[model samples]
Target: MSQTSNSSSRLSALLLAAMACAVSPAVVSAQSADSATAPGLPATPTPNATINLIRLMVERGLLPAADAAKLVEQAETEATQARAAITAAAQPAPVAPPPLEPDTVRVTYIPANVKRQMIEEIRSDVMAEAVAENWAAPRTFPEWVAKYKFFGDVRFRYEGDFYPDGGVPGGTIDFNRINTAAPVDYFSSTSTAQPPSYNADQTRERFRFRARLGSEIDLADNFTSGLRIATGESSSPVSQNQSFGASGGNFSKYALWLDRVFLKYEIQPKAGSSFSAIIGRTENPFFATSMIWSNDLGFDGLVLQGKRKVGENLTPFFTLGALPVFNTSLNFGTDSTASSGGGKAYASQDKWLYAAQTGVIWNINNDLTLKAAIALYEFQNVEGEVSAPIDATTLNTTSGFIGSTDSSRPGFAQKGNTYIALRELTNSTLPGAGNFQYFGLATPFRELAATARLDYNHFEPFQVSLIGEVVTNLAFNSGDIASNGPTQLPGPRNNNSFSGDYEGGNVGWNVNLQVGAVALQKAWDWTAGLGYRYVESDAVVDGFADSDFGGGGTNLQGYTVSGNLALSQNVWMGVRWMSANSIAGDTFKADVLQIDLNAKF
Candidate 1:
């Protein structure tokens, strides 16, 4: 049915071919020749669309102009007959039915091969637009922006502190305050002032909350960066729970602190396991429990970490780090060693902690696994330094006042660690001569620790795990601590001196058994566990240990029981109870209860 066209109609044929080729591959314009398409879309099943389809075949030289014209004519006739058939099927025609529809996709010049190719091209275009305007996680953003991911969590807790009924009220020394702020005057004959007292044997309750927001960005290489901010009542490194409004006013806004900022890089060798390095403040690089490193503590400085896969069921890992504990002040002796212009210069006494750990993960079978590690952490220049004897008669005429090693004093400390005074006053005659003073840790801290965990999943959806860790402070020596200046224990001080007995110990350990759902996910799924702990006076630095057991610190013995229930995805609630008592100091004990609601993204 092809009629050859002469030169007279060749102009028309060329024009039709040009228009058909110029149309977008995805869309036939909504304003096609007769505007034969659905509202707001350029799709298939339209008269002009059919004609364009035939002309495109001619333009691609798949069919001649005459044959394309013949096809178009036949397609129009079929469409007209199809409409008449539809009208007759309905006893009384409503009105002229819409010929073009968003749902109709059939091409009138339908041949099997051509229809398949045309459908593929149009589907490709539709998919591109759908992804760009996707309802969830739109993909139209820049490639670099797509590499970023954000996550965070918020927790609200109600904590109750119950003190023993028979305990006394005010003998505990508030050394933490003295170390960070001012010291009590002890040298003046007329001065009856004493160190600030801690709140011992007091029952209390408070509402606290912890909030954190962070972002992780993946760079082009195998490098990544993380940044986070959190709420904290103070600048303490081990606690991030900000208390609810208890100030003079109600509903006060709180402060946010920089909690984590770090850069990490990793590389997978072509034939071996992966290796990595991290810098700045980030999560602790070593695997440890709260008895060794608190859940909220962040490690700062440089750390190197690696894991080697030995076999299908065995992997060995190691970590090493050097961290700065304290940096010396520039103008440390200004007041005591003052001149007409400014304070005197002092020697630098910075402190550092060097740590290392090696461990392995052993998967014995489908139902059992074991993980174990041994670690060493040594604190350098962390011991207290006593100042030179001061001459009583020359109090006002001294050229230098502060000690050379005063900067070695810990800017922050917790309970259970033995301490000594930094000043060695020679019976000053002046009034209030001991107004400025400081204290330092009596023992250098070098902890050696061994830990292990065994997990069994014999019960289908539940797991049974046995966990244990033992730690000893290798540097803690009662003789060395007592030989220094007057000692300060956790409780009351006796005549500002040591009792001459072995007053402190170096070892601590904890073990726990748990049974519950492997992980929290759906409603009513629950988990419960119980554990016991015993920490000697100097076993581990109390500053970085768990803050919830016995009001936070060491020289404590305790047992903990906890239970959690999942309410929905990314949300859960937990209840915990801890009963703790002092291991061997003045009588002290407490029972703590905490109920928490947590959510994460």
Candidate 2:
């Protein structure tokens, strides 16, 4: 019984030891292989350590092999159950949901009344500020005044005229003897005579200025009115510059004259198409250069212009115009002569000009543009005529001479037209009458002109342009021009006759190349150009050609070099040089240099 008891205690002790080993950290770590795959089962135990312990126990005769195996199995089973219980305890518990309410949807928003109140508050503030700033003040003005715009420009210039010594051949003339029997001696005069010639080679300098003011107003729907006042002589069509020394020793105030006043009406029937009519001393209605017409010249008459777009990049245009170039009305009736006596006579006539043009503008690409035009211009009733007043004078040798009586001549002679002097018919009582001359327009003028321009603006802030123009006179009648006879006045054998064949057939051409910084606002902005022009005598109305070239007349060929540099946003300085020579009857040369400062507003 004592031995049995001892054996039982030993087995109990061994079982307790086995159970402690199974709960060891090593055993727990080994059993972590896969608790997920098997719910109450441990991973297969590692046999190395467990097997050694069991064998030692058996060998020491503490227990039989089968008993050791049974103890090991019991330990593993307990450990697996322990691990499963731990895993189960670590898992989350099932949660119970709260009680349900009735079905409904909820929305949160400001009330409409509150939103309206906020908007009204903002409006009231704005209105109060506007009232404080006088936004509700009543305004009174003429309806026409509200549609008007005013603009103008001013220019100051320093000019120089330089002539070489041994003056150009055929450059001298005696105005007093222009109508004498002599041949006028214009072609054979020498510059180095004992007394210098009238047009002796010399240098002259002067300061000049020009100013203009203009206004445009909308008169009615599609109708507009424009007017301009400028500083210059009323009869001068090509220049507005006034010389500083004309005051005769005092500070002289310059004269101002009407430059332009016109009315325009436009109609647009559809997109990309329009037509316009202008009347009353209007702007030049053609695409022309100074080669054909001066920039300052205005036309007095009516013009019709129209344009239409054919495609995205092409436009065609047309212009037709008529202008009254001159009007002369004069009466000669002396106090000593009866109302129906032979002394009463009259001279009256009118000159008219008509023009037509067709052109196209092509925008070749984003950077290039081209324009071309063809034009025809005609002059009518330009020839001088002999007329009789209501109470006419009988024909007499001394009475019928040009300038002999007030009825024989026009009141004013346009500056640049070729003229013939009537020396025998002069009146000593009249001042500046010793050299009276008559415009020799014995035939009409018919002209055809072609023009083209190209512009390239691909380079930023810089542009280049090439321009060309050609004009030809087609109504040349030498016979009719030469048929013009001397004055019928009886004098010392009127020796002066129309010396040469006065034909109207002539050609004029001009070409220019220019490069510049297109916008002249920034510092250092500049432009420059070189040009050549050749205009034959009678090719165009000399009074309307470039007034600064060759002393403002035709029969000239020249080269011009010009440049401008910006001084400020709306001001610039310009320099130009022109070297020109006459192309007809006499050899004449002139050089003009100009420096100008200009401002615009």
Highest lDDT against the true fold, candidate? 1
| Per-candidate alpha-carbon RMSD to the true structure | 18.5, 17.4
Kindly state the number of residue pairs that clash in model 2. Answer: 2
Query: How would you encode candidate 2's per-residue C-alpha lDDT over 1-601 as one tens digit per residue?
Result: 2443444456557654855555445544443332323332223435434434544444434444556667656555554665676778789999896655677545569899999999999999987887777564456345656899899999999999876554453343322223222212121122123211234367889898899999999887899999999997345777888888764638867789899999999998878889999999987889988988888888999999999999899989999998988665445333224233545443345677899999999999999999999999897765443222212121121233333222223222222233332223323223322222332333356889999999999986899999999998787555544544344322111112235433233689999999999778866799999999998766776657888876665677889999999988889999999998766544557789999999988
Off by over 4 Å in 1: 1-116, 128-140, 186-189, 246-249, 270-272, 338-342, 391-403, 429-436, 486-502
Q: For model 2, which pairs clash? A: 181-495, 342-393
Residues 1-601 of candidate 1: C-alpha lDDT, one tens digit per residue = 1122232145357656656566554344322332332222223435455555555444444444455556667656666665676667667657985697878887567798998999999988888777776643454676777788899999999999998775445544657887776444543565677667556776789999999999999986899999999998888899889999753338888889999999999998844478999999989887788987889999889999998889789889999999988887777665664222335566678888899999999999999999999999998988878766554444444544565556767776667666677765654556534434577777788999999999999997989999999999998877666668632222222212224354567899999988888888788788899999999878988788888888787878989999999999789999999998876545567899999999999
Alpha-carbon shift of residue 105 in model 2 (angstroms): 46
lDDT (C-alpha) at residue 179 in model 2: 26
lDDT of 1: 0.75
The per-model lDDT (C-alpha) reads 0.75, 0.65
How high is each candidate's TM-score? 0.76, 0.66
Give residue 573's lDDT in candidate 2 (0 to 100).
93
